[model samples]
Target chain A: MPQPVIAAVGSSPVGRTDFPGRDLFSLALEEAFEGLPDPAELADAVYVGNQSEQYEHQIMHGTLLAEWAGLRNVPAERVEGCAAAGALALRHAAKDVRNGEHEGVLACGVEKMTAGGTGGATDALSAAFDRAIEQRSGVTAPSQYALLAQRYLHETDATEEDLAEIAVKNHRNAAKNPRAQFSDEIDTDTVLESPPVAPPLKLYDCAPVGDGAAVALVTTAAVADELGVPWVTVAGTGTAANNIAVAERNMTEIEGAAVAAESAYEEAGLEPEDVDVAEVHDAFTVSEALLSEAAGFAPTGYGYQSYLPPESREAGWTDVSLSPSGGLKARGHPIGATGILQAIEAYEQLTGVAGDRAVPGAETALLLNEGGVADAVTVAHVLTAGTEVAR
Target chain B: MSGEDRLDVDSPLTLPGFFSALADGDLLAGVCADCGEVLLPPRPACYGCGSRNVDVEPQPKTGEIYSYTAVHTPPPALEDDAPYTIAVVELDSGGRLTGRVDANYDAVGIGDPVELGTRALTDEERSLALEHELEWPLHVFEPV
Candidate 1:
């Protein structure tokens, strides 16, 4: 079957902002309808992906967003898979098109975080874990990932310096992305000298908490052709889940992302070598190295090694062109909206519209979105600008 | 305020039983009777095998830290306890539990031996919980 194609993509700038009277759904609607000729007349269904309703004090956002966006009575619902909620929603919308359920589906993710300060936001994000157990022990996002980083460093030859390089590299990339939350470049000395949030995880190691939304319009291949809009084929998509508690699974292996990416690569009939540009979640600096290994881009115990210098591609170390959109590190993570943003980045890079940060002559792309600690729920997708499915 | 501020002790996995056992001088874990997989927080069912036949087994209190972090930034509820060490200790029974490790922040490291201990909620912590409408585990781990 011809797969669904992402017809259009849009997003709001990612940063820490207090948009006084604006609500979550409206933020989503504004970004979703951006640049569309007549967005109100184009959708058959809406899928809203959000991780925490506690942040906005609202629920049932799918129907709420659809109604607010002037979609009227069309089918609309929300899907949750923690941080990967947006990717999961996009996958569902794509399947809807592929199965002939809806010719077009609007998939978007939005999170309004400033309503609650760091404390409120931290508590809300904690909802992703096994609440009664994990949250009760004072394990917040940084603490959870800190454990993973400690274990990863202990077992591997990689050092904290390698992880710092990742932050430096991502910030450099984000400097070229106008929408990113952080664009300033810092060296390993700065990263190492930064205040420690969780031991081994300095302030620079974490993604900033921010408010944003990202949207993608997916439609049947026929509809995309008829609309005559610039689009990218959703060549493949896969998702998987893992134990909710960090203690239950192997800390070193990102089992969820591995499982999801394997299926995604297989379905796309492509391998790691075939990917030209890729974006993997890097909510924490450690996450980038962990996910790089999980996504098969780097050898086990050597994910951090890939980030080090030959120092440029001409140097000697392998040129792993990862996270060109700044990633969650410098780009900011608005939770629900993050996954869709990855899709938007994929669309931009593949379509040659990624401005200064664009990868030259990029063709094939991969996007990975992860949720919760060690990516308990992960979604992976492969995209191409080509009109036809090569497989 | 009395100890009445505690989390509901009746739920299947409220872990009140686990904390109660610690106060009674024992560490407990739920072991599946059919598959022999041990679970922390005492689940009603076996996650490894589809079996509801589970037993609350006494666990070895001492274990080596599998991983750890000295938390400098904490949630509002844990603000008072900022710079506390949180570690995931792999118990001798093979069940891992995430808990606070009562040690000097820079002194603790991965693989350090630790043992279960009960922590009476401080008046400040209790007030914070009351203020935030939060529930916290009333237990911790200490260097053994």
Candidate 2:
């Protein structure tokens, strides 16, 4: 069986837009096929991932996006798993291609969070939590992460300064990303002085709400060679879920990320040391710290110490880069669009298309996507430039 | 002035109709007969085994703190009394419940022994008061 290769990846300019005549599905579809070499050719099928219909007020988004993208009458399906929506879509598409059901497939992810105001958006996002237990008890995302942050602080020597460093670094990286929501340069003092949304988590510690879409074109390696297209192969993908409520699990540990990374590594036949670059889910500063530990980039509770100081990056610590695309913090998190955006970033970095913030000589890149509070569900994927899989 | 002037009190001694049997000073938890897993908050179904055969049973109220956090910002109703500890208490029957910790920050830690207690409440004239409120049941954990 021939492995599927991502032939092309495209994304909308990921910043706050008026979105007057355009909806999320429309905007994403336009971006997906924007620069296709052959506009007449259509994907054999389409896979769309969206978290909530309540947020978009549009139910059947898969069909709507397919029609809007001018690929109507093709088989289209939508997959939802909280924040893991995009990864799930890719997984389905990969399966279809691997099974010879489809020659080429299109996987797109979009979220119109700004369509709903803050309160409504929050309610939609909170639907990912256990309605009977966590949500009813007023355990929102920030509150759950706040508890984790408290426990993490107690167990580790990490301080507020360490978290601020991560914010500063990502923000600096985002300044180079034209599509990032926060393009300004932020420093450690600015991050630390920001008002606390939840204890130990300042306002800058959270990823911002924005609207965007990302799409990838996946085809067989044989098709890629025939079409004369530059391609990066999907080495492996893994996903896992943990308890919805933080009280039910150990707050200091991210079991879901660990499990997902292990499966992905096993499938790719690669170890943590093999990854040259990573686009981690840093929805919150503490999340970056804990997830880094969980993904085996650093020891447990010591992820905060892994921050490459601004001076250190200038002094050549950029070899092993994390979030060169500004990440969720600076890149803006549109919920459903996050996982797909990570894929696009990985595609860009691996192909040396990341412009100014590109990682040098990047061969193996891993993208980790997380959804829900306290690291509830996590999806990880490893992408490589070479065709290691035998056709 | 009539309705607004009435004194309002929220107490841990309060037991709702669902938990009226607990007013007798016995602890209660909703247990699923099918899977034999006890659940806190007394739900109607068993999440573990996905069984709807659940019944409320009296159990011991003693437990230990599995984990805890000092909440500096309380809910709007509890803003005045800021900086309270909320904990997940693991019961003797291997069940866990989240409630307020009735100890100072330094005194409380993970795996600390705790016992459940109720807050006493008083009504007007100290005569017409019911034993407790029926809606808001407060469960506090004190260092054992």
Candidate 3:
């Protein structure tokens, strides 16, 4: 059976501004056809990833998006799971190609968060949480993550400085990314001096709210060969979910990431050590550290050590070059589009299109996308260079 | 009449029941009769045993803090309570619940002992939640 490969990818610049009076459907349509050679030729199916219908007071996005994108009369549906909506859509698209259900599929993720102000957006996002319990206390993403950060720091040797280091590194990397929301260089002092949104987590520690869409054209390896286009094979995919309420699960660890990554590594017949480049969810500074440890790149209580000095790295910490595309921290998390954005980075890095920040000679790249606090849902994928996969 | 008399079992397996029980000064845990898996903020079904036969069990009011955060920027509902503390309380029943902690942000720490307490919701909030069948009783944990 031929493997599924992402043949083309397109993404709108991630930022807070609305896309020139267009809504999510138009954004999805524009990005969907941007990378394709012929905008009129549509895929066999369309999968739209959308997080909140409450944000736009609109539903049936998949049907609407496909119609607007000229993919009429095909299998189209919306896939959602909070922030991991994009990754889940791609996962479903890969399944379609693998099952011989479709020769090609268009997977797009879009969210128009700016339609609702910050409070309204926060309320919509909180709907993904345990509404009866967690949200009742008015807890939002930053607050839950803040609790996780506090617990992680208490249980480990990590410090607030370690958290700040992640923000600093991500911002520095974002400076090289033309599509990032915040490309300006920031130091530890900048992060430390930032206003505290939640204690132990300053404003800089959180991913900025923004609106954008990302689309990937996934087809079989045979189709890519026919088109003679650059591609990356989907070697492995895994997803896992935990308790929605942060308190119901272990805050010191992201078990979902570990579980998902293990499954993906097993499916790919590769270990964490074999990954040449990686993009893990960094919605918050604490998340990068927790995910690093959970994904097997770093050891327990040492996830933060990867961002620390060399002395820390020497102690059982073989760090992987993380988030070359600036991650959600610097790239801006537009909810539904976040996961697909990570996949885009994997495609770019594997195809040698990632400028300045590209990992040299990268062959295998891992993309990790997560939803909710402490990883209520996590999706992991291993993408190999098309050349290696063709064999 | 006592608060207990007003409490009805009509929705014991639902969130409103959880709040109703809290208002009556009891912490309820939905114990799966098939698997004995306990769920806090009670649910209608057992995720483990795939059974709807859940037994409503009352948990002790005391628990330990598993994790906590001090919110400096709160949602609109909690705007006035900015800089307030919330914790993931690990109940004696082994179930976890996130509730507000009535303590200074600097004073509370992980693993600290806490007891469940209820706060009456504002009239507007209570009426809205009641009309929508939402839980209005605020369950908070205070340092023991």
Which 10-residue span in candidate 2 chain A carries the lowest summed lDDT?
A: A310-319
lDDT score, candidate 3, position A27: 59
Whose lDDT is greatest here? 3
Q: What residue runs in model 1 are displaced by over 4 Å at the alpha carbon? A: A20-35, A309-320, A387-391, B1-16, B124-137
Q: Kindly report which residue pairs in candidate 2 clash with one another.
A: none
Q: For residues A1-391, could you state the per-residue lDDT of candidate 3 as single tens digits?
A: 5588998787887887756313544654565455556533637798878898877777787887777677677888889888999999999998888888888888888888877778777778778878777777767788889888988898898899889999898888889888788879889999999998887899999998888888888888777777777899988999998878777676787888889999989988999888878888888899989988888878798888656543458456654788888889997888888888899888988988888988788888888888877679999999989854321
lDDT of 2 by residue, B29-57 (tens): 77889988876656555767888677767
Q: Which residue pairs show backbone clashes in model 1? A: none
lDDT of 3 by residue, B1-144 (tens): 347534355566666667777788888888989988878877777766779778788889898998888878666566666888888888888888888899987998888999988887665345425364444578888899
> Candidate 3 - CAPRI tier?
medium
| Candidate 3 backbone collisions, by pair | none
For model 2, what fraction of the real interface contacts is kept?
0.04
Question: Best-fitting candidate, measured by DockQ?
Answer: 3
Is model 1 an incorrect, acceptable, medium or high docking prediction? medium
Off by over 4 Å in 3: A20-36, A39-42, A308-314, A388-391, B1-11, B32-36, B44-54, B123-130
